[model samples]
Target: MTSLTVDRPTTFDVHSPATGTVVGTYPSHDELAVEAAVDRAHGAATWWRTAGFAERARRLDRWRAEITRGRDELADLVHAEMGKPRSDAKLEIVMALEHLKWAARHAEKVLGPRSVTPSLLTLNHACRVEYRPFGVVGVIGPWNYPVFTPLSSISFALAAGNTVVFKPSEYSTGVGVWLADAFARAVPEHPVLQVVTGGGDTGAALCRSRVGKIGFTGSTETGKRVLAACAQRLTPVLMECGGKDALIVDADADLRAAADAALWGGMSNAGQTCLGVERVYVHTDVYDAFLTELLDQTRELRAGSGDAKIGPITMPKQLEVIRRHIDDAIARGGRALLGGLDAIEGQFVQPTILVDVPEDSAAVTEETFGPTLVVTRVATMDEAVERVNDSDYGLGATVFARRHGQAIADRIESGGTSINAFVAHATIPTLPLGGVGASGFGRVHGPDGLREFTYAKATTRQRFPSPLALTTFTRSAAIDSAVDRLVSVLHGRIG
Candidate 1:
């Protein structure tokens, strides 16, 4: 990574949130630069689409291999730029690779032309449907899980035969550039994947550009802005906004397992995960026991730059939001079961657990996006389901009931749910990941993900003509009366 900041007007410095040191420098791409990138992508898309599924698969496999070979270097940059533990960074890379492979392997079957049975009215016609590339897609990614999240869209988009112009979060610009460069190494024929680095302005420019589609991952407010920009040209958009995800615990749930999963889900990556468990609704029957186990596991956990299990908050400004949530919870008569306001130390925030917090508090209502959890007790699983569904953001969720986990998971108004596991739905390559309602729309994995980047093209061909020629001018009156009698005979079965 280049540490020196070029004294140019179109460049900015990227600093490590944990160390407060300059990590790399990236260009502050403007509207013109973004437009140029999209233009290049259009040329790439033309060649890429003509490259046949087999050849595209071969190139995508090479790209995946290149990423695997350089995984360590990419992981290191992820850690340095986003402050996630090196292990977590590697894990994200691993997941991204799996999805990439899945996309490459399954794109043909998912998007290739397939014959469809026509309706009775068009029985003489042969109908078929196929998904075609949207030419160029603009992806605006988030900082958290920088490598995995963007690739979730980029990989699928490429496999669907579309070129991409990625605008990674300013905080993780180096990682984005690194991934794009790796793709270039594997597929040197054309610029199928490109990265545009900058802040909100560059992202807005990408949305307003002539790209075929936009894939955005950020806050709900930011997602709305992206939609508004894309709406200018009626450009299609796929959004994966952040969520205030919750975990439901029933009396039949494995208390020990739930505690362990909750602690990790709420603290890992400094709790920066959009699907991280920020609110947990536990059954009163086992609330005390569950709390005991959760606190016991949390005792050894710490957050810092060194060998701590949890890393520093990737974005410095998020510290204030975490602190304010904790303060508001405590002021509203919430009891701290673990760390509290004092747990927020400079750049690092130790895991904090607040119990008996009001459901309407900021800690529960808004997305904290930090290492904090608020556990609330409910009388029954019905209440738990109701409370979890009450949120405006319907993203991913977790259910810990051993006996009725799937039933409860089915009722939660979220995109994906993990039964007796945490964030498990996201790791599986066969499942589509996205949110409902304010959590944003569209998916980014599995078959749905592959189709999200492309448009459906339907074709019809006349196999044969109908025997009854009702259009003949000589016998039109007689044919019309005959057709009316046939319709009445076919429909007169009603008693």
Candidate 2:
């Protein structure tokens, strides 16, 4: 594996958790090299933005074809690097390809020019708004859902005519490199998309680089630091941070369906997903039934290396955090219905289900980022909603209400909520994907994601002159008085 040198002797090793052997070693990039990469990206960005949407779309389409053709190879890389099941790896790649397709197909319509009404003050002028690409975008991706999360930013940015400099999580560097290689084959004329591999310092350097915008997806604490670094250069950023999302089950909910959805959402990818369901609230009347079904469904899950239902935790350090959360819950008088801390052996953390965990416990409040969930009971639907909304992170929520699904979903304080489903809303290409509060700001998956990488430029041209002309220094006080009178007449309220 290729490596970069830093001031200090820093190194990262990728190990096969299933086999307990070193897979690869990568070096940390020094500050100087990072600066050089940013400079190169600047020049490449100018060329990319000049290519226009038509050319860019063609390139993106070709890249999509490349990914589609090599889906198995890419899936294998994902499975080897992140330890997700082969099926799940394939799903991630498919989702990424879907995003690429959506971005290419809709870029022109979503970001094309639109007419805007010129206010009375500028009556003589016609106004139009269009999106202008940011020069270069710096993307810092996470390990969980490596392809899907990073491509969410990368594809949209490219569609919006912005170049991308991606730094994938150290755990998934190989996948990142493969993605860049595919893009290079699609658009060999310019280095519009490039990958920089390293650790935290490398990511920090990207934030401080001259990139026009930064898109980071990771922990909330790390997001804050990234925001601070970007602030130094006044570079805008889109932060997709940690999430402790909840699943709310109403009295009328289908317990079996809800249990199945929650199990897949919480335990898939070993619970490393940012929008993974961490906490579940069920109405007191049906809490026992829901708990029973959830526990039974989760207990059947197996985490291993070979063809299993789920794979081992990719980041070894996360194993300790998952163990800590299980330990804390067990210590706080919570009962582990299925697996516990002891279940976390090596990199495989057995699916865990905890009941009666205190609301104040770390498992409930903090992001476990593991295959464990806490199920709680609430007396009323209102109480369930309140509990789900009480957290600092509001990335996504799930509502399992047969009758009032949409109403309950709308009331939740989250970016996206799935009614009668878990994370199904995110698959819809039209709806935006992001979070509020501690889950961080900005979006990454829909028309909103495409616009995030561009700035709105309003242009005005004089089509015809109106009776009232007020934008020039030649305007008289009499005209201003007439305009004020018209404004008052239109908007004045009765006393």
Candidate 3:
């Protein structure tokens, strides 16, 4: 509802990728400033943790309402800062609101104390497990889908009763400030959410400041550094590194649907999505049909400054990566089905599609992080699944078979999958979103996300005295023998 004006001697200018004009300026937060923000968040966490889920949920719901009310202002900032279409920016905000609502509504149910079926050996004890807030959570977010990505961790952390200090990418600091500003309005008494604007040094400061946990969303290479830095304090971390996701089209799949989903998944937001579809594996039986339909859909889309289906690449430097991957694919026996190397003139990279790219080419192997898709024909779904699984990154996958979508998706080595569509899995709050291997670890939605920012505390209380107790030092040797006999009676068959 309001803008947060952060003051510091040092500042960084945010330039619009679409116009190459200065859009906004943000404080270049130093290590001390970052520490101060975390210190404030630490104090806030204590009060928030004791606020109980009911109170916290009320505040969260209020914040969500404010976000919905301020959608246009926030969406304009998102478009100016990240170069995403205003509509797409609003979608991100809506998705974030849904996630926030889900988190607030589910916190008590997901994190509260619950009776656990304790081991039979400890039947005399009443055992229960509960999740506790980790005091403070540090979030290092990405520029693409800034609102949705950062809040994926922030909302869940807050719902779990942890105060959060978020450092959004240098590009989207305004959006972060707006979100925190709205939060301040919702809960005026405590600084439950804070934002620090800066680059790498400030992020490192947050990691070393001993925040209870760190949630980072960025590149895998950078994620490794975040993980290593957190090891200084043994601080727990959850990483949502970008992924080189693929869309697989089985022989029986609806080719039109596959092409439609692939185009939207790969080209939306100018293909700046972490789980953006980078590769396509179509069964040979339908490979030609799928490719034809994909190109047809792509032809209807364009990347530009106006109301185009896509927008410019938010990160200017990524243009080089996009060009490299396209060049590598074309130079190494791949044919450009649609736009190719020349399509990228300025900040905008027109939708580019390649066919027959070598499996080892950078276009297929590495994360292009651009609006480009590499299509490869495969002999069968088996080959498609194997090729998709061979990548080091496993963030998300899409299977387009109506009949066998679930079966084929089950074999893909990714955190989540969408049947007949891509990117839809992200809207489901109950499905945990994260990646395997190089795509990074830890989740940011669902129950797994609620637990990501908390610590599990297990407790046991004596419900009744056991006939033969083993935990007591006062127990006799005959009692120990009796315990052994009980164990033997319960487990002798296994040994």
- Highest-scoring model, lDDT: 1
| Residue-wise C-alpha lDDT for candidate 2, range 100-163, written one tens digit per residue | 9999989989999999998766777889999998888989998888898899999999999988
What is the TM-score of candidate 3? Answer: 0.97
Per-prediction CA RMSD (Å): 2.5, 2.2, 1.6
Q: Write the per-residue lDDT of candidate 3 for residues 1-495, one digit (tens) a residue.
A: 122244545889888889988889887878778888887888778799999999999999999999999999999999999898999999999999999999999999999999988788778888999999989999999989889999999999999999989998998888898899999999999888988888898899889996999999999999989989999999988988978899999999988888899988888888888888999999999888888888877787889997887888888889999999999999999998889999997998999999989999999889998989999999989999999999999999999997899999999999999998787788899989999999988898999999988899999998999888777899998998988898888989784
- Tens-digit lDDT track of model 1 for 42-127: 88898999997888888999999999999999989999998988888999999999999999999999999999998654678899
Best model per TM-score: 3
Candidate 2 lands at a TM-score of 0.95
Better of 1 and 3 by lDDT: 1
Off by over 4 Å in 1: 1-9, 468-475, 478-495
Mark the regions of model 3 whose C-alpha exceeds 4 Å error after superposition.
Answer: 1-8
TM-score to true structure, per model: 0.96, 0.95, 0.97
